[model samples]
Target chain A: MSRDALQESLSAVMDNEADELELRRVLNAFDDAETRDTWSRYQVARAVMHKDLLIPRLDIAAAVSAALADEAVPAKAARGPWRSLGRLAVAASVTVAVLAGVRLYNQDEIAGAELAQQTQQPVMAGPQVKGPAVLAGYKESADTTGPMANGVLQGQSGWQDQRLPGYLRQHAQESALKGTESALPYARAASLENR
Target chain B: MRAIPLLTLLLSGWFALPAHADEAQDWLTRLGRAEQQQSFQGTFVYERNGSFSTHDIWHRVQDGQVRERLLQLDGSAQEVVRLDGRTQCVSGTLVAGLGNSRDAPSRALDPQKLNQFYELAVIGKSRVAGRNAVIVSITPRDQYRYGFELHLDRETALPLKSLLLNDQGQLLERFQFTRLNTSVVPDDRELQPSNDCTPIAVANSKAPEVQSTETWHMEWLPPGFQLTNTSARKDTQTKATVDSLMYEDGLARFSVFLEPISDASVTETRTQLGPTVAVSRRLNTVDGEMMVTVVGEIPIGTAERIALSVRGEKKPAAQP
Candidate 1:
């Protein structure tokens, strides 16, 4: 590709208005040092406009690429009767991507943090009942890395279903008894009985 | 692909009713006050994953004084009694961590403050516990918070049921009163924690006291979240100082713990048994090599960012 075409492709990507063809063109030329530099420059410019902190020459893309590369598998091609195999390959890749993405997404979303946002439904919870006047705490607000985010629930067996409730009950009862906010904790523990 | 248009149509119709928001919040405010002022008693059941229990509650409001008691009707005689919102006594398996009887200020539900994080709307109506109810939806304004839907008693404005939901409306947990009566009040005997109800010991496991900000700071935090407490606890056995800082955005809360790992080969670990997420990241600070572990119910990406944002206040340049 000519330098001008590459530059146009880079600009389109920076604007987030690039078509799939344009994205392919830029990604194809990603190996060239000059092209990479230009891409970084465009990213810096865009970052500046968005008021995001721009670390000059920071290789975040390198880190992301490295993270993505290690988990990459040779995806099976979509073909006739063997499409099931290809679907399985896609599912495997998605799980890998989601696991990595979960770690990054947890900081902002403290609880019930959903990953694979594109494919998964966000998990919800019931009302937050405060304990009596001991002290108020956002209970486990930062523990968003629960089972739902792990995406293992799709195939959850009886074992997980059985054990998870026990753990949850134990934790809630323990928190209510051990901590302040007697009423809220008691309510939380009691709420477990609501069918 | 074919459902996108239909979904959009539903969404547009959903957003079209703007006046409904205020109506929903009004119901939520009522539910917040229901238990305090209303004298009601009934048998309620709580269910989650593996645990299920049934309990009877008696609430009395007289001369501006509110007294309440809860008893597990089945299995063990798990029980608790409270005056206003403070626990008086308890029975059965009361875990731990609840503050002492006369100590620790109780934080009430401040609907106004919570409004900052959640958008309140009365989405629709529903029936619960054999009563007509109004559905109040509290939609989170940001990714940091979760949304809630409450079914309030039409007459007393008390919350008969509440549902915590994510953006996609998947139910995580539910709390509802199976049966409630506002006119009935229980006797003095009902408002008591069971015989085994022991008072919580906060003084023994007191949180550590933070010395000074001369130690470390978070480089970034989600807007509206503020640091509420900082402490430094030394493990008696290991003699390691574990620094913990807690932050809350009124409704949502999180804690960051920093500890030194000297020559200890602990790989990065993440675990979530239920609604909790724990993440530990190794970072180099001016004080030497330390591990930053963030435990909360937040998303992993947010936790990762928080882990990376922890910087030594004494040396901001020390980031890895």
Candidate 2:
């Protein structure tokens, strides 16, 4: 592809407005060093124009590819003392990747934690209405106890709601059938049907 | 003189601690033997968060054989009759899917064995069912099981009230006798099952018809729990052969159910019903897609872990 046309296609791809031909052209030319440099420059320019905070000199795809390629080379090495060193290198790279992933995940979790706090505001406020005594007591507030007490998964209408009762009944009945504790198991099974 | 009395009191206090601990253990040992030796009739109440029911029990020991009958006082006449610790018959809702495969008889409460899992202590004394009681607390050593606060009749050594408590010290369930009488032996008329009671079909020990292929196994289990029973039968509704395995750690019990769900797009889910938690995970197997459901009176997190650890037997493809 001509340099000008390739540049145009890269811009279009970045905008997410590329036609099928333009997308294919950009992807095909992505492997070229000059093309990748141009793509990075375009991304930086776009981020600057949009006034968005951008991470400098960080190409996650390239780093991942390097890590993967580094991993593959060690596997093909001849079995010798050097092979063990190669395995160690692969392990080190894997550790780095996992650490990077965990760091990124933690960042996402921190962001999500703020949103979760907002959603939980109402739940926290509900128990306050009961009284200060309820708050001071160890008794967990209603709808905030165990997953079963809150009926967390029961309302979703589907196979789970349909099949779970049967599964629970079968388990309770089957346990009752065999266990020495006749009354407890039997009571558990009967309670399932009571619902 | 004051110093001498104080010194003696301190010495006696130090010695009393171990003696009290032994008394609690002895009460548990007596509880194990009480069922076999004592004859009693009592009315008890079983209570949970959403459930409360009263039951009447008639336990008779004669000729070295123990026959016990329990009848629900309110609602359905749920009755169970057991002779020598084996269920002879059950009424109302109890009759469903009751197999007669004689389970290994109930293990006697071994204080030594129980001490390994529970921290047994005689906390104090109280009154239960109008009788003096010794409050023996059996706190679990691990989070895998719940703790029990058992109140034993001081005179008879029979459990008068039992409370199941979670790790948070919150009561999950309570079994307490409202009234109890160990003085008189219950006769056969009182021990007989009501008309609604259905006789359980005793399976021929020689051959069990529906033997499980035992194709599935759990990669992990909570410590102390062991597989107690396994069965395979065609599900009445789904028409799929369902394999089930039951596990117990003496105090806690859980059941794992494996059912083929190749045609259904059922996603993995978890639900808790009162004390029982059910965790369902969809697993792909060599044969097809299977739904592994773990249900038990266990912690929901433990149940979820158990659900994820179910492994189906790997079979080599015959075509190759």
Who wins the DockQ comparison? Answer: 2
Worst 10 residues of 2 chain B by lDDT: B202-211
Off by over 4 Å in 1: A1-195, B1-17, B71-80, B89-104, B201-216, B228-245, B258-263, B283-291, B312-320
lDDT of 1 by residue, B1-320 (tens): 32244345335433644686667656666766776678888877553333346678788888898787778777666777666665666654432222322243445556777766776666567777888888776767676655666778889877677655545554444457889887767777666555576554433244343243237678888767776555565544445666666666654456676777775555565544223445668888767787777755455566678888988756344444
**Model 2 interface DockQ:** 0.11
Q: For candidate 2, report its TM-score.
A: 0.65
> What lDDT does each candidate get?
0.58, 0.70
Q: What is the interface RMSD of each candidate, in Å?
A: 11.5, 11.3
lDDT of 2 by residue, B71-172 (tens): 887777777788887777766544234363337656656787777776677877879899999888776656677777788899988889887666555556
**Chain B TM-score of every predicted model:** 0.74, 0.87
Once superposed on the true structure, which residue ranges of model 2 sit more than 4 Å away at CA?
Answer: A1-154, A177-183, A193-195, B1-21, B94-97, B100-102, B202-208, B211-214, B314-320
